[model samples]
Target: MTAVEETQQAEAEDFLVDKAKAVEVEVPDAPEEIGRSDYYTAKEVSMHNKPSDVWVSFLGNVYDLTSVVSSQSRELESDGSSLVFPLIKCAGTDISHWFDETTGDIKKYVDPIKNMMTYYIPQGRFVHVPPAEPVSDWDNSFEVPWWKDATLKVGKLSASTRSLRVKNVLTGHEHLMEVPCEETVGQIRARYLEYNAHAASYTWKALKPNEEKELVFQNLDMTLNLQDNGIADDQPTFEALGISSDFHTPVIHLYYDDDLTVA
Candidate 1:
């Protein structure tokens, strides 16, 4: 080959090398969450609607009031008051409207009859709320109100939600579940337990793209979420590219473990 040709070839090779380096430099790994706070979805909170496992969200926070509901129910029954029924009726739901956003306390209004401030309990009075009029039988001394109690708070309410497809290979059943973006696989499984009582008797796996760029059923870490396990949502990218996000929803496959366990 001519000297000029050889020089041009070397220059072309150098250009390709520089381009590859630039591509690598432009792309970066997603940042890892630090001191990650626990978050729960509204659907998750709704699962425990009953008094035995009641949960409620208020002021963007989730609270597990199962024990409180049980104890309060008994106390109200013994006192011959049905105030606790209102709490049970509103379980597993958001009660933010019942509280004052600015003060983070129960809502109050000026009573027309009494001409004074009093709780505006349209849903009827529940635990910790004092009677509108003082009575001889009313208890004057009580601990902090349940709404202000921090111990009942389980986690923050999730700001975003995502869809997940869970398939049971054994029963040939496919179920779509809406879950919090911050929840782990273990928590998702707990949600699935409602559908299939023996959800724990199955080994959970997901169909994710491998190094070969082919989708395959891979073992999943129950402790981590789909994104943490390298299965990114990429919904925004899909939308920007004129591709539907629903087309790329990940599917989780469940294989029976044959543990013979009953829920």
Candidate 2:
């Protein structure tokens, strides 16, 4: 086997062993005295697995770590920036099963600097894996797969070719916009609500994007139910709910054209 393959295998074995050990241990409840320590109580240890080894079986191929290191660090240096070592080692082959047109996976290794995996994929590709959720002490620490960051080279719609229409459920008002195809649905939604008087009138409004709003464009047909009666201006709209917009007013369903799908 190649050196990369051998290293991956060893890492996989270590992960399984650690996983088994975790399953066998039972966590003890903290003492009533909050600050008190008990010798019998179990302590948590952060798993010490290398980022690359944590990514075995991620993309179905053992990637040459040398390539990832050479490419990413070189790119960073050319820009006169320092490259962190962990980010350099999280290299792997791109292998996404979904969205056939995507290609050329680039994986950059990143150590969890603040209990979060924060890194940029090459433009056009999205990161895949770990589901963007919080990490636990026992959770595996690995860089996302290459396919998650794969970008489309061609046959995709451009921003200039698309348009968006937004309706305010409260006032029966509508706004039309020409947006780029690359803009996220959340971005369009935010812009739509920004000028909406009912949205601004709310005591609290969520100004950021939510996970439910990040659904892919293909699933735009799904219908949503709004709460607080069918009154639009009194509460958030159905579109806001899907995107987790933080408005309390009732929302009504708003539809866009076929070409103008949700992100």
Candidate 3:
């Protein structure tokens, strides 16, 4: 268990250290008033995937690791300009699972930071990270496994890590995107509304070829649905979403729902 400070450059191998005596630093207490969250969609996080400007998320907290991966900073890189495998590959995305599987613990990322809330300064702009979301489920629901020793976790390519091609039939908008496998149709719809502000102009419907089913946001049965067509969320990723062609991705049709009330 090696204790590498956030200011200290880390080797791919430093992460491999795992002895109970390794990390001896003390993190400060949680803030007196850490306040509420300010969420950022996955699309927003994906925009910062460069060494000059790297950003990554875990569950929902976002962090700017640019200096950690850049040419500066304590020489974290071998040549002093590039980051190691997986970490570099995971820029601009949620690395919750990867960190979990790798060290079999998640604190390696947090422990290095000393204070969990330091990454959220002057929120809603350069960095939109929030204090860890309030727990509504389990106490550790959002946590990476706790380790007695700072074990470097083994990494796994998350199923949600695959960016698929999607098209909005109403606007003829197409994009390559990555969505969490754990997300429900309803969750996806909420995310869609974040950017497509004109959604009400044409009632947008979410669909997947695997189920050939159209999803209506207010329809709890439809929105809460998690599987359909010929695939489930965890396997054959893109295919599970019914997307089989790069030239022709699944289309999310939009049309006015007649039953919707309007003033």
**Candidate 2 local lDDT, 143-213, one digit each (tens):** 54433433211122221223334554445675655433333433333444546523322222222224676
Whole-model lDDT values for every prediction? 0.80, 0.34, 0.43
How high a TM-score does candidate 2 get? 0.18
* lDDT tens readout by residue for model 1, 1-263: 99999999999999999999887733333322223347888887888888688889999999887777777675552357676788789888999999999999999999988899999999988888888877666664657888888998899998777888999998899999878888788777877877987777777897778999998888888788778977687777888999987877778899986544222
The per-residue C-alpha lDDT of model 2 at residue 109 equals 39
lDDT of 3 by residue, 125-214 (tens): 111122344434322332322222123222222334323444556557765555555444444455555556444434434443334454
Top lDDT model? 1
Model 3 C-alpha lDDT versus the unseen true structure: 0.43
- Candidate 1: where are CA atoms >4 Å away? 1-37, 74-80, 166-177, 183-263
Q: Which regions in candidate 3 have their CA more than 4 angstroms from the true location?
A: 1-47, 50-52, 56-63, 66-158, 161-177, 200-222, 225-248, 258-263
Indicate the residue-level lDDT of 10 in model 2: 100
Least well predicted 10-residue stretch by lDDT in candidate 3: 121-130
Give the Cα-based TM-score of candidate 3 against the true structure.
0.35
Return whichever of 1 and 2 wins on TM-score: 1
